[model samples]
Target: MASSPLGRPTRGTTGTNRLRRNDRWIAASAAFRRADDPLVVDLGYGASGVTAFELTARLRRTRADAEVRGLEIDPVRVATADAQLAEVRAGRTPFPRDLRVSFARGGFEVPLADGRRPAVIRAMNVLRQYDEEDVAAAWRTMATRLAPDGLLVEGTCDEIGRVASWVDVRPDGSPLRFTISLRLAGLEHPSIVAERLPKALIHRNVPGERIHALLTDLDREWDRAASLSTFGATQRFLATVSALREQGWPVLGGRTRWRLGELTLPWEAVAPVAGP
Candidate 1:
């Protein structure tokens, strides 16, 4: 018969909208927007398939033909998601009865049939359980299955979806960028994302590490922009990010994105000092 799925099971902890930030990111990404096939995979989607359902809803806003496949290594989790999907199909759930989504049993290998390659594979919180040393290999395995212009988004986020960080890897398995997205309302320091860094960089958030330095600089700029808090958190975050760009932090995107409490930089800016 077939071999078992290629990765460990998740903690099975997930909540509604826990991945909303990530879904928006992917919806806006060039890989998804420009994909010829527009097929996306939600790898290791936990005990529920809601994330995949939510992802399809958001993506369809940009590409009506966008499709999402939720893959879980645990067959039981797949069955549960299939059941939930059935409810959705029967119009018993809030999701669109015609929502283009499916559930399957798979892992980092991202097993698509008929030699099909996905345009994007989102593996949020999936690698957190793997050792840091196992990250590169996993990235290669997953990235290899993507379309030539596809992307692999791997990262971690808090349960409520407020704090998040991820690495964008190309189909060749080379990481392209690192991003941190947070909720600015009632906020604290931006370095709070340190706790939720992807497995590749989580342990590298120490002194002398690039990721550590980035967080340190972010916290400093956030404090420097404290006076702007009177204008509101979004304004304050805009100033903080602008200050980082002025300091040559190589921040990506513009005010529109900064206002959403996002900061993106080349992977080289925060790649581990030694390696992932």
Candidate 2:
């Protein structure tokens, strides 16, 4: 709508509760809790708008006034989401009749006619199609459209939503942290998430890359903590994460999050290798 969509159309693959992990993370983030304005953008919410609806529902747990605007570059996809909204309005669906959500056609520009910047923007699985080098520019465009103190969450996840990782960027487009989340049940190794790294770090998973080392270490530590498995995968993961921090990985959060099979570290810990 704004000259161009800023990126190509996606396969629009989406499923019920596919983004539940992402939504829960947002609900718990300080950005959502302390938003001067509780407006959020779900950029590139694919073939279905269910994720957007789900996001608003989850965020409202922390901020009752939370609102989510689902932006899609494809007009047809936008129309589909809008149609679903209509169904809810007409009482044909179980979605809350007063749900705070909307669908629109736009891209990295985030064409919200109201001209108000959102407090949080979630761009999940939106940048995986672009060349690795193109990620920064896209991040800059979206980050510029944020409210002061706003947050941009960019990342990817497995098809079934079991494994996920994301980078948290500030309004100035500077990345702050990297987070990896897993379901932990039957999880063979943390490295399995190597395939779902954010676009900027996906190709950087080569032998000498920081991300590669991080995952490699995690796998080894996970094995070392296998003895804790008698307690549960949850205990094993917690021990593995503790080993990472003790080894100076700059791990963030604590057992509360680690017990959930989530690990967060400063961006510097896994940023791509500089230069070609």
Which lDDT tens digits does candidate 1 get at residues 1-276? Answer: 115778888888878999999999999999999999999999989999999999999999999999999998888899999999999999998899999999888888888888889999999998898899999999999999999999999999999999999999999899999999999998899999989999999999889999999999989999999999999999999999988889989899898888888999999988888785
- What is the C-alpha local distance difference test score of each model? 0.92, 0.90
How far off is residue 18 in model 1, in Å? 0.4
Q: Candidate 1, overall lDDT?
A: 0.92
Best by lDDT: 1
- Mark the regions of model 1 whose C-alpha exceeds 4 Å error after superposition: none
Candidate 2 global TM-score: 0.97
lDDT of 2 by residue, 181-252 (tens): 999999999999999999989889889889999999999999999999999999999999999999999999
Candidate 1 lowest-lDDT run of ten: 1-10
Against the hidden reference, what TM-scores do the models get? 0.98, 0.97
